[model samples]
Target chain A: MEEFEPKIVAFCCHYCAYSAADLAGSMRLQYPPNIRIVEMPCSGTIDHRVILDAFEKGADGVYVAGCMEGDCHFLKGNYRAKKRVNYVKKVLAEIGLESERLEFFNLSAAMGPRFAEIANEMTERIKKLGPSPLRRKGEEK
Target chain B: MIVAQQKPLEEIARLINDCQKVLLVGCAGCVTVCLAGGEKETEFLASALRIKRQLEGNPLETVTFTCTRQCDPEYLLPLDNLIGDVDAVVSLACGVGVQYIAERYPHKWVVPALDTKFAGGSLEQGVWAERCGLCGNCILHLTGGICPVIRCSKSILNGPCGGSQDGKCEIARDVDCAWQLIYDRMKALGKLERLMEIMPPKDWSTARDGGPRRAVREDVIIDA
Candidate 1:
């Protein structure tokens, strides 16, 4: 049987994570194929709904990758994104969903290797968690 | 504006349990202005619910709709098409909007996502205070524009009671005694004479005591 492939959605800040992903590609650094990146002008622009929507659309894990705290292109965009992630985590917990499914990471545009590391780390974490319980697979309410 | 707070997240989650399709409805009226039941809140709730369902193994589908004013029947008509396949509606509107939906769609299950608080406004970003008492009477002129009914701990019509000390109410340390505020303001404005005149007892007949209230303007009436 094929292993459960966790669908991870990564909301990447255009100035950092996206650039880092591009740099990783240029550097020939291979990462997990599970992560699907959605580029945004700033990580702060990624509303809580967008992350939740990714999960709703069958993503087993969601990530918001922004610039390193002081490195955010929009000054405090990454900070706002961080605050939102914390709030979403609480919301996820209240709904009985593991807060671990949503994550935020900071990396500089030049950190191609670090970007790949995150991709691998998040992928491994979700793999161990298996399919999301919300998948409507087994059991009755 | 009427300010309300979202119901406890856990309670809201339980209300939508077992539903395969849910509509998270938001209102753009008072709720939207107060940031309690607006499009953003709808998105937050829909996302949370979706994640919850996914984790529960029953992954339910959800759609979002925001109306200008859910309390009005006309505003909700547009949602007729959206409700066709949804099993339940999670209303992020005030109590009036929830009742309006329940009244219009007798067969559909309507769940309230917010706890109806009061006719108030935001004191700051996240803090809201009760401002209107809806007492069916207006006496702001006599009270120096501060409403004792809603602001005072005792709603005293006469003046500040003995419990008032150093401009704060004895009941709650943080609360500024409403009558004390009125006294200070009136004294400042040379309107202290207004306080000497006793107000006739408030006749609440026009309020909830009158069963229900209605207002009709004869000049604006149109025969349908």
Candidate 2:
């Protein structure tokens, strides 16, 4: 059997997580290639619809990465994003999806190692969870 | 504004279980300001319903529409052309909007997604508190803008009921005694003497007990 490669969507805030992702690449960090990053001015800009749309569009896992607590470029955008992510988790559970498929992570722009670790960790988590039921049957992984 | 809350997701999913196609109608009026049945909430519910149905192997097709105000006949007219295309309509508006839509489309199944809460305003972000009883009567002048009909658990017209203790109602410790609020406000404004005056028995005819009431302005009416 071919190894399952889960599709993951990561919403990265430009001031922090996005920069971290870039640093990870420059540092030659070995992370799973499954993560598809969507850059945003702030993680707070990611709405519930955008998160659900990622899952509906066949993402096995989704995570919003924002700045560390009290370290957001915008004073409280990370805090707002954290609250929204929690709300989306409840909504996902209500919709019969595993809440574990969605997550929120906080990191500083210098945390390249942490970004790679999160990418690898989320890939492994999704791999264990298997494909999303919303994914069309017999579709490629 | 009229405050309302969305029904639980489980109940909503069950309500439309047999439906294959549904029009999720949202109101841009009171429900929107209250954060219950607004455009964002409408889309959220639509996505939730679709996800639930799709997971159950019964995919649902939902079309979302937000009217300027569902309670108005003029705004609801836009739905006339689209009403026949769907099996049912899940309205995320308040009770008035739901009833208006149902009345407008007698043949279509109109299900309410929200439970009409009260005539209220936001106390803070995401927190709404009932402020008016809509009794077709105004008594705020005597109560210092604090409404006993709503804030008071027993709706006592004269003063705080016996259940009021330590400025809180007996029903719940967190609920402030409405009369206490009124008294404090009136005292601050040097209008405590007004409370000493006896108020006549309220006219009940204008209240809900009178049955459906209508407000007519003859001067504004034009015969068609």
Best by TM-score: 2
TM-score against native, each model: 0.84, 0.98
lDDT per residue (tens digit) for residues A29-70 in model 2: 999999999999999898988888899889999999999999
Q: State interface RMSD in Å for all models.
A: 1.9, 0.8
**Residues A21-125, candidate 1, lDDT per residue (tens digit)?**
999999999999999999999999978777777766677899999999898888999999999999888887888877898899999899999999999999999
Candidate 1 chain B lDDT trough over 10 residues, lowest sum: B48-57
Model 2 ranges with Cα > 4 A deviation: none
DockQ of each: 0.61, 0.83
- Fnat for every candidate: 0.97, 0.72
RMSD per model, one decimal: 3.8, 1.1
Q: If you superpose only chain B onto the true chain B, what TM-score does each candidate give?
A: 0.96, 0.97
User: Distance from true position, residue B7, model 1, in Å?
Assistant: 1.7
Q: Clashing pairs in model 2?
A: none
Going through the candidates in order, state the TM-score of chain A alone for each one.
Answer: 0.95, 0.98
Model 1: residue B142 alpha-carbon error in angstroms:
2.5
Best by the DockQ measure: 2
Considering the two chains of model 2, state its CAPRI-style docking category: high
